[model samples]
Target: MYVAVKGGEKAIDNAHAWLAEERRGDTDVDELSIAQIREQLSLAVNRVMAEGSLYDPDLAALAIKQARGDLIEAIFLIRAYRTTLPRFGYSNPVDTGTMRCDRRISATFKDAPGGQVLGPTFDYTHRLLDFKLAADGDAPHAPVAAPRQEDTPHITEFLKGEDIIQDEVFSDDTPGDLTREPMAFPSNRPLRLQSLTRGDEGFVLGMAYSTQRGYARNHAFVGELRIGKVSVEMDIPELGFAIDIGEVELTECETVNQFQGSKTEPPQFTRGYGLVFGQSERKSIAMALVDRALRWEELGEDNLGAPAQDEEFVLSHADNIQATGFLEHIKLPHYVDFLSELELVRKLRREAEARMAPKEAAE
Candidate 1:
């Protein structure tokens, strides 16, 4: 009734050998260095770090090289490696208010306290292919104004003063980590935000797009987007004070959505928050939109059953690694299962034919 295939060990070894050769194509060409990937392919490294939930660029770059430039695979490698490392202690929440901003912009206000600084953005670039880049790939640097010394206050804070935006309630509750525990239904805002931050950028983007296309539409305006480095500190029990551990680059986005009013609450602009590692404006913006969409019930807005509004659906399918693993697992051996199904179908057909033959003879 069943058969087991043997010699898989030898076949697997040969396949791995072939894969190693393919990964290092053209032995004459110099292999890509991890440093080159860290510096030159910085965005790729940033993405792997963001999705992997690890901040080490060097390790992220090494993972990229080992995965042969497959970013999702690189993220998977980093995540797998991260679990083996021993946990020392959790760092205190980094303060974005004191961030040393390299790029800050507010769409809500044309001119705020700290003027808009469009640093290293492709927003204004024309979609023209420069032939020069293909040859030498060197470009002249443009002059920039001196960096602002004063700390730029959040644009939402300005609206908060006038009670125009709904105030965010402060909480000391420890958020649940999905990685440590299984995800449950009806997740809170903190868990939702965590899922979004580590979620696949393209998947989050599509869900956010659905909200904009009249499926639980929340008219969102870019309140502010900031990219900078924030100092990380940890409280050492022996030292009696928090000490700076290091600094990490982060992108924070705040979106102002349509005003909501109820019998218990006054009409005020609602907010959606997005924070991610490195300069990921598009992902951050998309994240904010989806975050706000998921808060329909909390904001007293009717849930129109949109994909973005469904927390269970979004959070469950957001991780590309999980999605890919299950999807690609279908390629694995299923001969036994197929044989069982075949036997059942044949038995059912034989029984049906036996019954039909008796009826035909009587006719």
Candidate 2:
């Protein structure tokens, strides 16, 4: 840990005040409200919530506003705020099977049980600027569709029905929480998945992309990608029953990977699962790919020595908050260390010149 020594409290205080005023942009323009940011900048808020590991949109929005749209800074703010919150007992695991899906699609099949519901997405849109937004004009009203009354079953359930895909194994043991306990090496799948879900989006995305480019490549097909709300429940000890505490929107991705069986088992398609707090499909998909890559040992695959496959490597560097602190700390004053190094270099140069002087006289 690096400690930076400093003085000038008045200067620091003045700088902070100026920074706050600067965040207001111009005095002539109207200030942005938290509600406006929560609604208008929904994607940014979602990203902050996902990375911050906090599910509160309002708090995420406030962080974004305070950080002046710097997402990493916003996530840092939310994380700092999260520590003060009171802890309640953990809620029961959410069941994605009963999700009221806003969007659902399966890449493996041309047409699946739940036909693709294309919600608000930029996937198909051409890269073009909307000059209309410049004129302060409202967007055209989006065509409203009737919400489906029935809960949509996961697309993987059909693949599982035929007994083709490998079954997802589960244990009754409670998984470790990284927030509460320090992360240990040789992390279990539960802990790894937990890290990936809350990991930095860019870092995880790059690691996931590496796998696609043949670094421990595991050919994965998006068996199903669904985004919707799932209810969070908590059991009551008094009645041996559970009550619905609340619901949270989530993106769940299940990747089907073709595997050539090892000596211990027969060849069967395996699954990689990714679940996160919000509609973060990119992160979810990346999490799935990296999740699959990291499962090399369990699947009896060779250790390809890839970054994604390294448990400690990925988990250690995945946290943006931690990474930012270490990286940004270097920018703080290190004048004492620099001066010592500078003197050492000068001494070495003088010694080299002294040795060269004798050689020159002899020549």
Candidate 3:
């Protein structure tokens, strides 16, 4: 029998106090402001917002500051806060076709319709550390071209014209929210995409890499990757039309994989889709690969039993918050459980000794 531990409140209070002190290291140095975090660490803020499933940059920055720059913890804070807000109405899905694209590129074709506009990408940049950035030196801005307002055509569209790509029929059915409803087995594409979009970036990246290393290898080529702002519209029954709610930055990736055919269907290239909040190209690309791996059943491909191919496994472990909680719980006191295990081990050892002693005496 174990007695309950007391004085948890006092201990917690002291721990919080120490944490606060530690968060504000060096009183002489200026503390990091939320604005500074938002402006300077925008990528971190974007990642937190993407994983947290919230679009507010300000709240994400605050969460980052509160979490002491831990992205996962910041995501948790944002997710916790998001649950308190009242839902007005669901916004209509933004049309990426009409997106005001700042960057658009394709690997399938050297020359595409939009002509491979490489906007603000680190693709060609050398991985050398710029020591000049350490010191506060003003850098010259790259020359900007006039803004292109024309809608850039999707690379898949060109393939579709030649009937080289498999047709994706659009559905009017509403997508299920994983946050609101319990996930059932054999989830659909929408649910799988949702899970991947909010999944831990590193975990998703690793899973994608596994596929490239011959674990359910689906030869994926970047069909198109576009980063831009899309207007979100909300349908209003009173107004008799949808009104523009807001605009948000999004990164959309479509991967074209190897051709697949059957007795009934002709050979055509299949596709994997990924769309994420903010300018997260790497996450979007990884998401596309994982998405394709998870679509084995629907695409009539063999279930290779890969980690990325397992829907239940992917969905179950995607959440960092839940993973962190269970992992960290091991640090908590388990005195009674440990004692029970110790007793069992001792009993087993004693039983073995008694049995061995009789054998030795007989010998």
> Which candidate tops lDDT?
2
**Over 4 Å off, model 2:** 1-6, 137-139, 237-240
As for TM-score, the candidate ahead, 1 or 3, is 3
Over 1-363, each residue of candidate 2 has an lDDT whose tens digit, in order, gives 334666868898999999999999998999999999999998899999999999999999999999999999999999999899898778888889998888898899868876888777778888799787789758678788676788887887788888888888766789899999989998899999999999999999999999999988989999889988999999978869999988999999999999998766678888888998888999999999999999888888889899889999999999999999999988877778888889999999999999999999999
- Return the number of clashes found in candidate 3: 0
Clashing pairs for predicted structure model 1, backbone only? none
- Per-residue lDDT tens digits of candidate 3, residues 1-363? 444777698889999999999999899989999999998898899899999999999999999999999999999999999899998878887899998898899998988987899988888899899898888868669998777668888889988889888888987789999888988997899999898999988888888999999999999999999999999999998999999989999999999999566544567898888898989999999999999889887777777789989989988898898789889877777778888999999999999999999999999
- By lDDT: ranked, best first: 2, 3, 1
Over 1-363, each residue of candidate 1 has an lDDT whose tens digit, in order, gives: 335678799999999999889989999989998899999898899999989988999999999998889999999999999999898787887889988898899988997878787878888899799788778558688897676787888888888889889888987788888878888998899899989998999999999899899998999999999999999999898999999989999999999988667655678899999999988888899999999999888877877988889999999999988998888877778889888899999999999999999999999
- Using Cα atoms with residue i matched to residue i, what is each candidate's TM-score against the true structure? 0.94, 0.95, 0.95
RMSD vs true structure, all candidates: 2.3, 1.7, 1.8
lDDT to native, each model: 0.89, 0.90, 0.89
Model 1 misplaced stretches (Cα beyond 4 Å) = 1-6, 137-139, 351-363
TM-score of 1: 0.94
| Steric clash pairs (candidate 2) | none
* 311 Cα displacement, candidate 1 (Å): 0.6
